[model samples]
Target chain A: MYWNEKHECIPREELEELQLQRLKETVERCYFNVPHYRKVMQELQLEPEDIQSLDDLKKLPFTTKQDLRDNYPYGMFAVPLSEVVRIHSSSGTTGKPTVVGYTRGDITTWSELMARSLVCGGAGRDDVIHNAYGYGLFTGGLGVHYGAERLGASVIPISGGNTKRQIMIMKDYGSTILTCTPSYALYIAEVINELGMKPEDLKLKVGIFGAEPWSENMRKEIEEKLGISAIDIYGLSEIIGPGVAVECQDKSGLHIWEDHFLPEIIDPETGETLPPGEEGELVITSLTKEALPVLRYRTRDIARLITEPCPCGRTAYKVTRIGGRTDDMLIIRGVNVFPSQIEHVLLETGYAEPHYQLIVDRKGTMDTLTVMVEVSENVFSDEVRKLEQLEYTIKNELETTLGISVGVKLVEPKTIARSEGKAKRVIDNRKA
Target chain B: MLKQLSVFLENKTGRLTAVTEILAEYNINIRALSLADTSDFGILRLIVNEPKKAYEILKKDGFTVRITDVIGVEMPDRPGGLNGVLQVMKSEGINIEYLYAFLGTNGRGAVVIFRVENMEKAMEILQEKGIQVLSPAEL
Candidate 1:
């Protein structure tokens, strides 16, 4: 099915006019339907008539993850519960889950966006798409599933786990477009090797990896191993799940659906807007969301905006690589350690797989960070002492490089946990 | 030839005793041991009766220890003896961070455990000076 393009390539003035009109309608709907939005809007003294133009969007109160938690389940829904067709929730590690409601129309819009993302990344109508994303309250699985189906591609609803089965179906179905996180894509390649199968024997062509921040080093690794073009897709559950933006063939940055969502880069510390090409936190406001319209939502993800029209012919604003979350930065003995920084060091080492975990603990009041990484078979040796020495050497190298001491724990191949959805790679146990 | 076993220890009182106890359990004798302490931690370097075996025993007892092949020069245990080695190293562009000599040998010779910043360059310097550099087997 063809998606609407009236919002896609419209002129700036026309798009802003449409956004202002939708902003007024969304404000009135929220004020009449959702009590939480009413309270926040009332606190800001913002009436539907006050938002006469797109510039007035700044007057709306910023919504946060905490706001979603305060208004759990259906508290943020702008429509009745009976009208909602599907629901998705966050990881819920912090507290009660931040639930998202999708009406039938919302689901259709979501599917259209995902289809656009897949097509933009070079998926064909006849190609079979393998959906390895999980299929529950998580949006990665079903989001891609419906998108592929809507695009008329044969859908393999293989939800996570069972690497052997995944490979079997991938080969049997002649899948051309693969959708999964980059780490899981690597794990699949490993299983293919263990089963004495060559990656070139598979008919896969493209990969959409997202839900967690991955390095370009990993993208090249995945592409070389699986013989497929890898693309980084960006989305969060608060913003109607994973199809919000996707990378085109140019592999520069993800092309966001600016017609439906307005993208802005803000200084994470000051909440002030920064120009394009400057690194800052991303704040999105969904202009056309019907059931759950979010205004000035703080994503907390660190990245920059690219307003330059991409060489791939898409006029949508692009977001560069997301650095990391602000609050998740770990301070180890006065040394700040972000997982991406550790990933950067590991990628620079070029010895281990992309799969890794950071273990942090306090040793006599001093923080010590230990990296658990898989020893690639290319560098594997049977001598345990030699391996131990290699670990020590790597630890010393990382210590010298990052200017902070780190211990390296080399594990047997495939020991670290793999996820079909967002990969969890960091574990910090320091109380401070 | 002499070998040195470097044991990592926290700057606590009984930590060294625990390491020594592990060595004693394995019946390993400490020929020459030097303790270098910083404000945070300490490195206990020992010239053991059996360097390899002592390192293994300590490692098995959960002590972080490493064995390195070090050159044990036969010096006269006098001030000029160390100066002679330093003059050769300095002329050969070798920088020694830390070094220690074993005592109680009746001033026969100084078995020095010296660490050069660059091992290959230091080995080249010693080779050029015709000094005896011991390997792990020689140690």
Candidate 2:
């Protein structure tokens, strides 16, 4: 199952050396070409030469989602626009998108790494990859597409949605691997049963699911429902799409492709790197990307890195699957929706109290986003028709702003729980 | 008009019994009780001897309690007696959100507690039509 053991299974010392070399080169690239990175580096009086070893990585300034947002479309690209062969972004409803540009060589590197990731997930040239990640601007579809193609696996380039069609194609083609969000995979399994088709009718062996945070119970649910090994894959458009790390057949933790993306866990509040195995926010540095190589980019995904040797034999570290985020960002149906975004909409509508809670739950196979808000005592005491009309107006305004339909629960004042310091704004029952 | 106590309880075993236990401890006689439920929670509406006292006790016990205004309509023990009040309500466009009944005190007749869109108007109309409308004192 090892596609490129030369890089995937590099010895620890050699891997660190390779990471340091690539880190140094990427630092120089970012510090010279991109003004944002250059300004950030010069602010600390830190030069590329200072990062002679990987330990000096802490000296470099940490780039954040705000940094990517501040430098909107092409400001973060290290290479010139002509050098960028493709661009991908995963934008929220309100603000600027987190953009990633890829050079031709960068695409080749991504495909190679994605191929390695697929091999780790027990997929190979003989397996047919049902690439269900979205295509075009969103990175998942094309990322897995090119990666499966590079692995010499026959790829059914079927993008997300169209559940019945996907099942039909999968059965007709005898596709051996399914690729999409974990929730969508469950929805597909549900559809198979609705069509009176059993899991045995389809020849699915492995699933490469990512683009959202999923739980172990969800993994088991998918495995049992689809009669396949559900492997977790992790990636974001800000770094490279769908193949930065993946769970091997051992099903322990995600084996991060450390040769390309150097992973770190840092205290989100103090900006201090925690010891390995301690739960903290994950930060990644793009080591080999040519077009938009990032330095210590704060991923905001909370996880622990396991450096202990794994049965999979990949010396690269694995990150424990993330269960929560450091920020109040809620990913609803693959779209990132912040509580502040909903709050902003509520405030702009001029109809609700500042207090609100985002209740996220799994309604069957789909994620249900229910925004709970408390109204003024006067508003609640009003006639039922007025309250219903106000709820309608608030739902409409929120849908307009957040670009997603949400169940609006209007309660009386002082109903939503308040806090002393940080307000607990999101209650995600999906993990429970 | 009779004051009905509505208590919010989580949908779990022994929760309803716990509420009943609280009522029993306070020696509150439950005249009529109805339970409305959803998946996560349930609303228990009770017309007791002293709704104000029952509401205070439930509120002290950390239950979300609301004292609502409802009129008790005395129905003839016969089957059409219940339909008579409903027909009047339907003609007057008085929407009944919910209704519950209990045997009349002293074995006079059955009494139906009605939560209507306009409680005052329904009471006036029922009394004008020679229908018996029980007051809080009577209950």
Candidate 3:
């Protein structure tokens, strides 16, 4: 079941030695080649030799998303442009995009991590991986494509969209493994229902869903609807794409490939690193990336790290599913709200589907939140009073939980725009 | 037994039309209808020629639809006529959830569709009180 036992399940002492060696090499590479790292190290009066052990990692300066953006195209790259083999950019939905370059060795390392990622999900050479993650600059599609090929699996690089054609190919090609965002997978299940086909009819037995924050409730919904084991794969374009970590068959938490990317959870407000199993912002240091050697890149993604040995037996540290991104949180009338929180509420109430959009608007100086949730077909009621009761119940539950009043707008099924990659579930119309 | 079609609708511009259009496609004639809207959403109650068929088609089209038996009671067109049936129901300990009326026999008489807490109990109380409860055929 293990893909790379030498690295994936490396002995603790040996893994630490390898990490320290790699960290030292990376620090030396960055300090000597990349001016950004050199300036930061100089500002701290620190040298490459100063980072003696993994514990001393705290002494080094932290790199951030803002720093990456400041670098723009290739300012943060440790290697020369001629040596870099591939380049990928962030989604840039928020602001200016951050670009990353990969040397040939970096690509091989990424592919190997992805192979280990897929193997963690129980996908093998015999499995037909229908990679629905979008291709091109996003890094999800090509990142996973390389891994599927590396794992000796047949990859259907269908990319994203064409839900009908996806199902047709999935059935005809006997695709055993499905890879896409969880919401898109749910949409596929909805389309399958619309086509009057049960999940039992499909050959798909497992799913690789991530690239966005999703809830446990959503995971269960996807699993039951698709009749497959839906596993969450965690990764970011800044650190690496979808193979930075993955949940093993245990379905407990995502096991980070500590051999390559070292994970540290820190208090978002303070720079102090939190203890294991404490939730905070994630900071990653790339041990193997050659072209883009990011040192303690603050991922902005919120998650807790678990050092406990997983039942699946991989010794790599596990990250409890990402809670939400620091940048993605919405402040409504002084109350912080996350779309995932609304999703969790709806699913818990059993009144709405996984699809929903949080619309924030403003009148004068006061900000207002309007939650548009699609009514689940299972709970749709013709009785106006019952529907009203359900609506008020949901609104009250949200108000009590969120500590702010919100307008609940019940919408029809399939009305929310389906995402091919990451589900865009928030629309903020208030003035910035 | 009188079949009434209840359709759930969002209080949007064309949602009512959307439901009507589905019924129209099935050639189901809506004899009388009442819309109760509460800002966020609305419920369209319909007395159609083929209530069961309308409910089935609307349900198939992904609309929240239900077919329920509502007793249609004939009342005098004059004021206080509606109160006569309510008084009897209250006296008989029968609870009325909701009721709506429409002109019957060219505005000569009024028909009140009673959706009660217990349809059989309300119907029995109405029948025992010598009130005329119209059947599906009469509508």
Every model's DockQ, to 2 decimals?
0.03, 0.06, 0.23
Candidate 2 residue runs with Cα over 4 Å from true position: A377-386, A400-403, A421-423, B1-139
* Residue pair clashes in candidate 2: none
User: Per-residue CA lDDT of candidate 1, range A1-432, in tens?
Assistant: 224445555666776777677778877887788898888888877777888877777777778887888888778899988998888886442336679988898889888899888888888688888988878887889999888888878888887879898899888889888898766787788788889999888999999888766677777878888898999998888898888988888888888888778888888888888888999889998877777889889988888898887776667889997776767655444233556656666666665545678888755324578888766544443223445556677777667655567877765334466678545677766433
Highest DockQ against the true fold, candidate: 3
Cα displacement (Å) at residue A130, model 2: 1.3
Sorted on DockQ, best first, the list reads 3, 2, 1
User: How high is each candidate's TM-score?
Assistant: 0.61, 0.75, 0.61
Instruction: Give the winner by TM-score.
Output: 2
- Residue-level lDDT tens digits of model 2 in B1-139: 8888876555668888988999999999998988876554556788889888897888777666777888888988996989988998898888987788888879889999888888888888988888898887787
Predictions in order: lDDT: 0.75, 0.86, 0.84
lDDT of 2 by residue, A1-432 (tens): 699988888999999889998999999999899999889888999888999888899999999888888888889998889999998887554656678899999999999989999999999899989999878888989999999999999999999778999999999999999999998999999999999999999999999898899888899999999999999999988888889989998888999999999999999999999999999999999999999888998989999999899998899999999868998787777777888778777777674456788899989999988887765433432133445666788889888767667888765335577788555788988877
Q: Pick the winner on lDDT between candidates 2 and 3.
A: 2
TM-score of chain A, all candidates: 0.76, 0.94, 0.78
- Angstrom error of the Cα, residue A246, model 1: value is 0.7
Q: Is candidate 1 or candidate 3 better by lDDT?
A: 3
Off by over 4 Å in 1: A1-7, A329-432, B1-139
